[model samples]
Target: MPPTHLRRALAVSATAAALTVPLLGAAPAEPAARVASAAPVVPVVPAVPVVPADVVDDYYADAEGLTGEPLKQALHEIISTDVTTLTYSQVWDALKVTDRDPADPDSVILLYTGLSRDADANGGNVGQWNREHVWPQSHGDFGTSPGPGTDLHHLRPSDVQVNSDRGNKDFDEGGTESPRAPGNYTDADSWEPRDEVKGDIARMALYMAVRWEGGDGFADLEVNDSTGNGSVPYLGRLSTLLDWHAQDPPSAAEEARNATVFEDFQGNRNPFVDHPEWVEEIW
Candidate 1:
């Protein structure tokens, strides 16, 4: 009934509609379905949040224009202000979160071995992970109490045997390679962590030195130049630790861990982690 040109147009329109119908209604190809099913699902880790500039500014407001022991004392006052101390038992749960593997939520990354193990696999067993006091509790004699003993800033998850092997040794440069933790070296007097975490270890030690200044009934912690500092509330070789701090700057994970301690857990930030330049300025 239509004109010839109109009929041709209608036919073309109908052909397009017909072609679209199959594409719209059809299931995906069997090959595609099978390929998708065979593919592994990658887990997603939430990105670490950056600490706001104003927050850092305000936190260190009282510490401005200061250097050397005065700077150290000011920072000590700043970090020690209104801190929330966790019990030693609560630290178990805290490390599981703070040191959680970015690639796997259910696992934690060990400090020395760098192994990612199941979060619940924390204990004294040979294959498990346990709390590593980066600042040895024995050095300060603050064993398992809520203050310096349980501070999360210096606490980390570590392989059980590796933690034991690292036991209270002052950090220094060289030794035989640690048995299970490659890249780490240990001798009778000192233990050097793998290069990657050397700055992390140093900053934690610095933080302890600044945070606990012989007040609050806790021993005054310090970083000196000697090793074999048995139960003296001091950690050393300072010059070596300073080198480690310079050699390996703060990593993103370390910064994020610092933020987590400040924002979520400890209500205080590690000044060395935030302002690494402060290390050279002070020591």
Candidate 2:
């Protein structure tokens, strides 16, 4: 993680760590908040085969025909158990699959910017990239380590500058024009990712809230419509996120990434990406 000083200026909440999710539109600004690639390099990213349908079915069998909060809860219980945890270091390698270029399997794409860079730079610093905690680490006092800190479902490869700009801003509509990344906008309270990853951001946050289940040292992550440098373990503007999820839908990048993660990286699946209908079913 960037040095503690670089972390967004956050007050010691009841929990002491930083509050994640930007809250500029309606909530007050924190007294000073803060804050991929790709190519056909012949299998640039370690290709992860798709998880078998039967395997995925067996994995979510407990929630069959389930819907609403029960389905949500059941899914939480199901996905929360038997997950293979990876170290924060392993995340760097995992991104190669989760964020690969949709157009070219040989390369990985950066989130937000949607720029396709060389896959050879996976670990090399040729093009600067950092692991972006979509849920924002401090929200639950989770640092850059194992467990929630390293979960591949929510972590993504981001341009270093764009990542910093996003900070821990909550998700919402309306913002000053973003100069840093086209299609990106920021205001006093929140940051809007480019259209490309709108559904992506939504799905990741939703997945975390579902997967963590408030157990196993995982913060019971929540999604809401509130804003600000929230100290609680939740993200906001659920209504907007829902809209984004619907408008953008899942793309080839997301499908491939989900399969790769389940088959290779974490041995689990992002239910929302695997089954977008679950968003409405649960919410």
Candidate 3:
């Protein structure tokens, strides 16, 4: 007879072997040594895809080789041309499509909370999503008019309370982490979006600054280096926004949202989304 310890090991191995065997000869059972030494399975995470080059070909042709104010001007001209505006009412339907969750066709992704909620769950009640103006309409006092007020490029669905928490606050780093929306922080004067969408917020601000150059009846939106912009046609902490733009490059989802706005809802695109490098070039 085998030694006591050796016999115990053999018994356990025999049970494992028996359990692993197929009722009908499915295939030979893996050797005990092979099974014991096998590596743990790691789930594969797919890489974020990039927008095809052809989609942006000649779209920014007029803004090429330009920098600073000239570049800003060129991009504004490029994106502002023939934009189809939606009504404040239509924003509900447009956001259902623009910010729709990729994994769930019936849901849309909330901006600050990153929660995927049902498309129809929009209202002023708690625990629901509503349109969030990336560039607060009050800062520029655009209200809910059909122009900048309804621009799909800047509007997104966000949790109701989270939207109010971020109300009219400028973007910056550091604050107490929000209880309602983790990863986001807020101070008296500024609201810092979560890291994943920090670049998205920054790009939206930059796009607003460029697209609304005070040429139209609306206020001339601009970016500044300070906070507490309060009803002014400016958003701030530009230096921080620039840092965010570099830290978080455009994601595949963001690029797709830009394309949807251009191809379906809005007739124009957010240039910064298409060409992130142009942010530093102009700002």
Candidate 4:
């Protein structure tokens, strides 16, 4: 799902339906055995288990009084180091943490469709779910590389058709409600994810921009005011992202996702997801 890759064109009926209002398309279930990720096969945890008081307190404590680009820089220095690297191929396993089914740990939830697929149903199998690059791979031309390619924070399980429907479009206001996924919408050049995940997506983008700061030849991913960042590795619109960060805020689901990523897969937390006010602090 990195920025530059073009999703395969949608089939005619799927396209028309996706471009229409409030489509409640049902996701086909996938077999459980096909999943290859090593994540736990346990049942889903409660939506909001209590987070330990000190688990992430020091993660951003040093940035407490900083603001603007300096704040962004300090936070980046804090989280970007000592990260556990997963191969892009292993994102399947990581999804079990970042995108798991809240009610079923044996499954992963598709972002746009809100459908649960067997965790093994990952990758590009037709009708099966696949890793979606919130920051499209093509724009930065960084495919399957450790930082952008395999970063669990930015990758998510998405319905194949709905992911295809999004097709590298920028996130913005206004568009037809997705026929394939409720709460999601698309139009000429933008995407509107369902309200529940809006803040989740915003925080993910902000996290990517901060975590992969081009220090080690990785793209200095950034969020801007526009879209179609080409080979630039940037996602937009920043103003819209800022608004969504505030408007939707972080839900219990977002908190749980961050906790799982830290306690299980990535080892480093998405600061914004863990602390929403960071968005206001740095931007």
Please tell me which predicted candidate would have the highest TM-score against the true structure. Answer: 1
Please write out the lDDT profile of model 3 over residues 24-112, one tens digit for every residue.
10112223454332211111121432234665767778888999889988888888886767799988977776665544556666777
Candidate number with greatest lDDT = 1
Among residues 3 or more apart in sequence or in different chains, the pairs in candidate 1 whose N, CA or C atoms overlap within 3 Å are: none
> For every model in order, what is the number of clashing pairs?
0, 16, 0, 19
Q: By TM-score, is 2 or 4 better?
A: 4
How do the candidates rank by TM-score, highest first?
A: 1, 3, 4, 2
Cα lDDT, all candidates: 0.75, 0.67, 0.73, 0.68
lDDT pick, better of 2 and 4: 4
Model with the higher TM-score, candidate 3 or 4: 3
| Decoy 1 TM-score against native | 0.83
* Candidate 3 residue pairs in backbone clash: none
Residue 87, candidate 3: Cα error in Å is 0.7
Q: Give the runs in model 1 whose Cα sits over 4 Å from its true position.
A: 1-48
- Model 4 / residue 9 / CA error / Å: 36
Model 4 — TM-score against the truth? 0.80
Error of 3 at 228 (Å): 0.7
Report the C-alpha lDDT of model 4 over 44-70, residue by residue, as the tens digit.
333335346575677668777888898
Each candidate's TM vs. the true structure?
0.83, 0.77, 0.81, 0.80
| Residue 3 local lDDT, model 4 | 18
